[model samples]
Target chain A: MASDRTASQPESSRGYAPASGPESERGAGPRAGSVQCTSRAAPAIGAPGHQAGAGPALHDLDQATIVARAQNGDVSAFEWLLSAHEGGVFRLALRMLGDRAEAEDIVQETFIAARRSLPDLAAPQSFIPWLYRVATNKCFNLLRSRRRHPAHPDAFDDGSVPAGSHDAFAWGEADPRHQGDTCGGLCQDPALRYEAEAQMRALTGLLQAVPAGPRACWLLRDVHEFSYTEIATIVHLPESTVRGRIARARRILAEGMQSWR
Target chain B: MAMNGGKPRLGCGRLIDDVWASIDQPATIHERSCRDCQSARAALDHLEAVTRSMRERDRGDAAQRPSSRVREAIMAVARAEVRRSRRVPLATTPLGTIDISEQALNDLIRFAASTLPGVRARRCTVLRSPTPQSSPGGPSSAGVVDGGDVRITLTVALSSQVRIPATMTLLRERVGTIVQAQTAITMQQIDIGVEDLYDA
Candidate 1:
């Protein structure tokens, strides 16, 4: 959305709301992240701090008081805390478990665990990593179980051959010159598009093949951009162990990705 | 290489796993110039591309979000957790003062902000600016303003189509008018923020 001081157009200037939704629907998050502002201006209720601009930085204001209230049996405060963290917890579970149904179950389990342990939580600053740590464990448990039950559904893969076994560019006898370019996703040429998609399928297989420990480290580092220390906290490992695991995961992934070249 | 399940593929040699895994490691001259390392590097690049591509697709899939039932269950638990009575005093009068809960006031603000053309007011923080004599750190309540000007700070997601300036003006006016009219609380500063643009 355009920022402050954008030219004020008359209502008439707003043409019939565009024919359809915005072309890109990326990063549309869950409603739980919505802030319920309670200003300290009133003696009866005060959530504290009315930030002029809105962003993650603004939302980062401590919820120590709210968390304290929740721990002391304030349902309202608990609700706000849950809402703020639920979507993120769910997303983490989805990515780690790779199954929507399983992720939902883990989300439920994570909240239950969080609620039980919240009173013991040291402070609001650690709330996010603490919550993530809970969800990550739930996802880890599910992954281990899925490994045992070979028949379990793997949303991670769908019968595509790994690119390491064949030429990724050779999709259904496709073009030889179609070098996979990461110039934003889909290619204009149908053959190149097919090749690109096949390569993605192969990579997905390799990702699923990664053991849970290294996979979490690699994903938290690469995709979620968690710091090594933060990751260690969430995974309950030494900082050095986290680094070594991430490096090892990368090495394994590099070998598996070789065919994409 | 043909598609064969049992056969091991001829893949890149050892540099990627042993040397490149720990990215902090500087590559030797041979490792940098070797045919296998170059191919390994490209493969690593492709690995990143694949993850990025997956995230993009996953982000677009809004349907994958948790169900409404989950939200309802959470709200149910939260509401059930509030055992104590809740009330907000609007004003004092000769007969009696009308009390409105904090949630009710916030609801009014949300309602006012939503009525504006193509705007969803999210995270509305209504703070009463401290009086000139009072310390800045003074605690302020939701409805018990104690005769100080009210400052409304909120984040809103704007529709992609509307003109931001006009909408912002409408938002400030609507919020101020509603808060004043509903509870006799006059607004001093209305801080409106545009957080994100949505398809509406």
Candidate 2:
């Protein structure tokens, strides 16, 4: 679907008119904390901060306050909550679905469903994980539907198989020459960044071969850095099962990614 | 070397699970001295590196914000949901009854309340007054009456310096006047609660 084609456009530049009133002042861009790359050895993708686009009055309020207000049926507070988490939700969906439009649909559905059930969410602190659960279930449904109907046959058809083995380079985008280049801090180099992105695209394509359950577990654990316990709650699986699935997924991807070493 | 369910067995005859476990936790004594386990761990480390790199680049490249059309559609649905769920009875005549969206009424009340120098609206609920024949103790539901008086419960955060009595009276008067002037619905009661205090 050429999902990455819009990669460079800042979200605010897109024509979405922010809701009128105080929320309009909230920037519609990615929260700064979400995008910072951490140490690779033990990367911990922190919970998203709610500081972006906050007006002076709301600036001091914590996420719990915003959630509590939303629970009290404050639409503006809900909108702020939406704005804060939409980016993370969208990225999760995109990685899960690999289609831009479908991912966007999941984001819309997730928040709408969330609004309907927000009153029932007892703990304001559990909002993020609850939100992720909502999003993950939607993705699972879509994936199940796709498996039944085969809507996009070419979505996972990377056609990268070489000779007898599934070489990493055979996966369309990444080149063999860049195999060992970690591109860790060199992401600032545009050429390296582009290569890294291409490799990521290839990795996403490879993920299609993993079963949906393990795929989700792997993404939540390895990519998003959710704790195993948190992932179990989000995916509705036992903690042991979640760990097993993640290990199985790693084994599968490692075999396919052998050439990268 | 042998295979366990198509997975390569380590030279120590351990299954792939051992390699994964060693990488996930601190290496056991045998793993620290085992060449096969070390080799497997090195390969897994490279895979982890690749996954981490993918995550970093994916975050960098993925669209950080949803497109405008999607945002508008989602918010439109949200606003509609709020209006649908919380409509308040405005009037009822022989011809028909008129209702006002609770969201709209809340917006009006909030705006009116904010005009006061030291108050900020936190939450507002408009409840329909029970018809006179109903049980006096019966609960009054929102948007239930064909045409009748409405009760408003507004919660606000007040600035520390505002005179409590005067601010409360002024807030009540302003809110009552605005609802009456705009919607022509008589206010049976205006309950204002100070839920928080903030500096002016």
Candidate 3:
């Protein structure tokens, strides 16, 4: 049943490298002293005196420039590249781990690995998927290790998996009691509807119950709109398998969400 | 700043958690003074705050406002990246030519100058054109000539201990090779500006 859906079909919502010390850059000759008014050093938004001149327009670059510079030990270039893509990457990790800090750590580890292997990046434009692959592997390893040592419990582990109990992990059912606190509304008025809070909690709970792989697959495919080929390349999975996982993940999510009615 | 620790204790994680939980919410002073505990508390506080805010926002219809300043900052980071990747000059002078777009040229000059024997220091910049001075010789009398196309110029700050003539020759030869090979820019002249002599 899971294998029937394509990876591109919206299933539902889903979703390091070592980082250099935040202050390193490589250059020729007397390195230009740190740019005092550099953008990274300042708050881009909501900062005082933030006129148009304060911000320079920066077009997003494909991975090739980043890989080349990083290979040559240009730490700053690599860092900028990291910052540019971190939001999407971080969001994916957060969706999977349900822990922001752990997701951050995974991102850091992913980059460290990427930096070490930058020389092997044949095409810079192809680096994003490659990077995601590396990061996913690291996260999976962390998950696997946590499984082996039960003491280090992930957000997903709630004693059900170990006992071979499947139903114990409920999905998409929000606690009416904490509905006010766990909602995920984008622009609905809080005072307008008390029930929306309950809906949000249920959505979050359902998202939390998704196993990491399917969860990742669904988020990448549905929320992020990555192509099946791209998802496959990143996850190191067969395209068909990616499709199946997403389908399964979505069915579970949809079924879990059905209770909201 | 090292904490007191003799023998290592096993199950330290559990012990720490237990002790941490037992503390009646710490006074502001106590929390602020301890780095480790403070970090933990801050993490928890941040998580709680973020989650709470997210929930509150989810309950409302407030459009997520794009912070112009933050957007600008992000743009700025991207711009700095562009500048970093380009061949650009830190500063320009009247005598030297600076091309901010060529990393190859910068690397070549820096590498060549560093290799010059006894040349302990180096820096490079482009010279700005000087304003014309009125003299009897009309156009020639005006000192300003558009020298931008003449050559790729480099100003190397050298050490006083080195033979200026010999070092200059060696620098010209080596820098010329590196620049041509890396950037494909043939140089008509490599103007070596001796900014300051480094003490041995």
Candidate 4:
């Protein structure tokens, strides 16, 4: 019944490409003039001037120079790269897999693989997207394997958190001191905080119902704030397909979240 | 336009997809004046808000950082792999050969150079003496000869307060002694280049 209804929906609503879409729809790079929906408030991964605690000399070096040094077997440079990127990689893994230990393992494996192949990377600018691709692929493989053998009953088929997991719902409840920066003074009120946390928990529960592929696209777009071109490159999908998956995921989540309105 | 659920469509006839797209993109002429698109956008804006909130929460989580143990393990693996791929021949016997990693030699030279009062080693390249029978026109490779003489070139950054000639003499002596002591190979020559300068 669901498939039938989906098939009946208009192609535009399903996010299929129009007969003559904009040039940016042709899967060009970030410079192709596509409208990036999210602002990157955090320091860009691998970009210079963001190395807070690195040595003064290393801090002054750009990412390309650092990558070149690492390629030449500079262990200190590699360590600097790891320190800069490990957190972002871990968060990506955690969101995709919903298991902390497994996510940590993915981070370790990704960097080791990167170290082994660093010499072969032809372009230094592609390092961030390439690293993300490695981590995302590992998550995809783990999710695929989980489907074959259901080890954790609480984790969904797509590896998202179960509705009952308190960790999934807690938000800032466990440590009020760590309330996220976005909530500001509104979250200072206990009543407002509780209400927001409840809403977040409900929304997260709804997210688990989304299949893995679309969920990944949605998370990369909305949460990580990757441009559509970057998402397509990381996930190894065409730009149109990425748009379609994100749209479908959003429709499902919005439908499920109607009650919150 | 078609509506999937039984929810009211306000007063406009545009599809809900158009409304959602308009939330993230510039609105079309029709969407700008349409009340239905505005209402649907307001409703859909809630999802965007929650998603942003979740992103912030994820960022603020202390647990998101990889553990120190994990970092150490990654570094250990990387060092091992890099060393394994690059071993320089130190000595050879009729029975077998003894080799040291190029990285180990570089680390030794860098450490020795760093002991100087105002020098920081940036890079170290070791050139091993070619075997006696090797072709002269062919490429000269490191780690071919057993107990061969090795040439060392060390790049360093110096403090503005240091004298260049005295620092270079001290650096060459220190690196030569350390390399000879550690590897038992006579240094053919040691060349030091001051590549950068820093404030004292």
Candidate 5:
């Protein structure tokens, strides 16, 4: 009778990573200045703004079903939902806040808020956009509070991850064509690559100089590939305003880096 | 700011913004060589690099995710939401009552079960049959382990090459022996769930 025990299964519930921290581990990242894509930094999610191309497909994980089940008060279902979206939420918060602990707090708060607000959420299909809305609000609120009691001496600190420690694209996740194609023929010299990386690192602060509205739009477009409609939904601006912000953000980024380029 | 606003278009005559919108493909070969276009391209690359680097760091750094303390907090909430008993009676003596945490007992079972040859357990849970009064919000029971009977359910990752029936039989016996000898708890039922077969 004991030879073949029925296989016991796990609950498949997803757990939250901590937000409160000594915040020391993340202190090693692209602080105010340096940044790179070590094996640790690159997620298999492909590029944020770059359209997913011929790389490995990320379509296998179906989140819609998870969301539906979570709405029914299913704990395991909620775990599946958390597992699917937490990475993006954390990343967006980290970029906008520029402080790992604050980002962690935002992420934890986002999930908690999501848990509280799920009953009113009507559209499961629009969960990602809706999640973005909740997280963006939290980020904006934090930014506003920071303004009332500022900590830093300058806008961009440049005290991030040290240079040359981590590889920018170590895992070959970059489209072969991205590094090897048109741009490479012109800018592939070892020195040019080094300088370009340095200039990019330095440009981190300037990104903060971008007006908040356009910065949000730019990040939504460039960092997350959110469309005009998705962006308008989150920012509560008209579609026209969304388009303008994206354009303005691009222009500002290009202008800010004019000296570096 | 107007430095590139009036500059000549790239060899293809497309504005730098247009080229950047379709970064992978430039209408003209000018994308690689034009002064204004290169700046815009570098800006796009810089953003991409930031996203990439941050992601890698988050995945690499254990701190990026919720710490174990956070995990417990969430689990605590989950425990409240679900109606699962959290404690198991280990013994009863003049020193109040001795009990083992449901999670602690599971961990004990997991360590024992996975110690066998070709048997690696993932979620080893020592479950108790819920009584009529008990509402199962969580899995396993607080008083069930000391009740001297448990329904142990675990997902085992087995070596595909092993003799399934024989290996599992020996594993059940070995793990059961370990649980009884060390914890002195009776094995009500040891259920082995084969979650996946691994080549290694």
Candidate 6:
């Protein structure tokens, strides 16, 4: 039954959208050609900054006022907050996952989880760490999956590695001559690319060596500059334990990373 | 080696450990004067600096990549999240207005809510409109009126194991206190909408 739909559809248009629908007979619409399946922007539904008939940034209007509004199921307030932190959250996911695509997945998962457990949140103003914890968990889960399968490294001229072992060659072989011409181009910034690849490798190495509980604690406290109490709250570790893990993680990072530099 | 898992004893070691937790904090006087400790501290400091520097460098570099694929992936995730939240009745909760980032507000709300006893589930959010029409003026004139009046809400469910009304009142008081204490908001009102009542 599904095969007939596939037979009717042109071979050229096969990707996410068609595959996503339930197996049905009406999949016979003329397929759009080479539609870049990757454009992920949500259709501007409610409006640019608002969604679902909710307001925007009303959460910040006044703490009490916004809280009262949000409690009434105002999604605009939630979205306004999402818009404000999307960049930072993306960066956090990117660094944690060490892959842009995976980082994006983590960002999406974090918000979804937040939305699921959002009502559980007691304070609107303190959502950053919780969001990060969700993002970190999602990235780690993806990384675990990727590590199991392993794939060919991306051939970016600027020297990024899907896997860390190949980074040195990628960084060293990039051409300086072309760098001038390709300044704004994605693969052109050799020096910057080299550093990014190297740093990810270093972070990867450091994280692997440290224990799990400690690694998150350390990253939140040191690299990300979260407080001890905050780290404790995020990781579900005791404040003293958070302190200890951070200390131990730091000592390990200091010892292990010195060799890389 | 992990610390002796017993209660942490306060001493130079404990103090040293705290100082080491943050990279920007200076090495303590005791750490600087003791030759062996100083040497170890130096090693740790050097390693931390290089690793942090490498990450900083990587973040800047990754931004220049031409893969709109990466951007697409992020947007995909963002859109999926929005859709999922819309679909799940349990996912929708009124979180009050918070001037912080979405992530930040979520974390704070989670922390504050979880700490208070008897609270089962909660969601924090700022009030906003789907289409934020600018006021007659622009941002300057856009007050609460422009954005449907700013609000942050936290809708909570009492533990199925606890008394609903008592828990709700307790939550309202505690949450109100925490919000006012941690953030600069005189909460207009914590709705305390009790979604469920659990039988003991």
Each predicted complex: what DockQ?
A: 0.11, 0.21, 0.02, 0.11, 0.08, 0.05
Clashes of each: 7, 1, 38, 0, 24, 60
Highest DockQ against the true fold, candidate: 2
- What lDDT tens digits, residue by residue, belong to model 1 across residues A1-261? 011111221110111121222222111111112222222110111222233121222123224433543454444456656655565566667667767777777777777667768768855335667777888887877766775788864432213333443333211211234334643345687766676667666765677666577777777666555667778988998876666566545555656765565
Error of 3 at A186 (Å): 4.3
Model 2: pairs clashing at backbone N, Cα or C within 3 Å: A160-A170
Best by TM-score: 2
Best by lDDT: 2
- The list of candidate 5 runs beyond 4 A from truth reads A1-61, A150-200, A258-261, B1-19, B28-68, B82-200
| Off by more than 4 A, model 2 | A1-59, A150-181, A184-191, B1-29, B60-65, B85-100, B104-130, B133-200
Better of 2 and 5 by TM-score: 2
What TM-score, to 2 decimals, does candidate 6 have? 0.44
* lDDT agreement with native, every candidate: 0.54, 0.62, 0.45, 0.61, 0.51, 0.44
Q: Which window of 10 residues has the lowest lDDT sum in candidate 6 chain A?
A: A1-10
Order of the predicted models by TM-score, top scorer first: 2, 4, 1, 5, 6, 3
Could you list the CA RMSD of all candidates, in the order they appear? 14.9, 11.8, 21.9, 13.8, 17.3, 22.4
Off by over 4 Å in 6: A1-76, A91-99, A139-204, B1-3, B6-29, B51-200
- The candidate with the higher DockQ, 3 or 4, is 4
lDDT of 5 by residue, A182-250 (tens): 221135577755654455455556666655556676666665656667778988878766665665555
TM-score per candidate for chain A alone: 0.57, 0.66, 0.61, 0.65, 0.60, 0.50
Model 4, residue B139: what's the lDDT?
60
- Docking quality level of the chain pair in candidate 3: incorrect
Can you give the lDDT of residue B183 in candidate 5? 65
RMSD of 3: 21.9
DockQ of 2: 0.21
lDDT by residue for model 6 over B132-199, one digit each (tens)?
45555565422232122224455543333655444545555565566557654444434433433222
Model 3 lDDT per residue over B1-200, tens place: 11113111112121222222333355356445645444333322322322344434522222222223433444444445435443333235698755545433443455555565554212333333443455565655122323332244443334435665556666666766766665445555555544333334
What TM-score would you give candidate 5 relative to the actual structure? 0.47
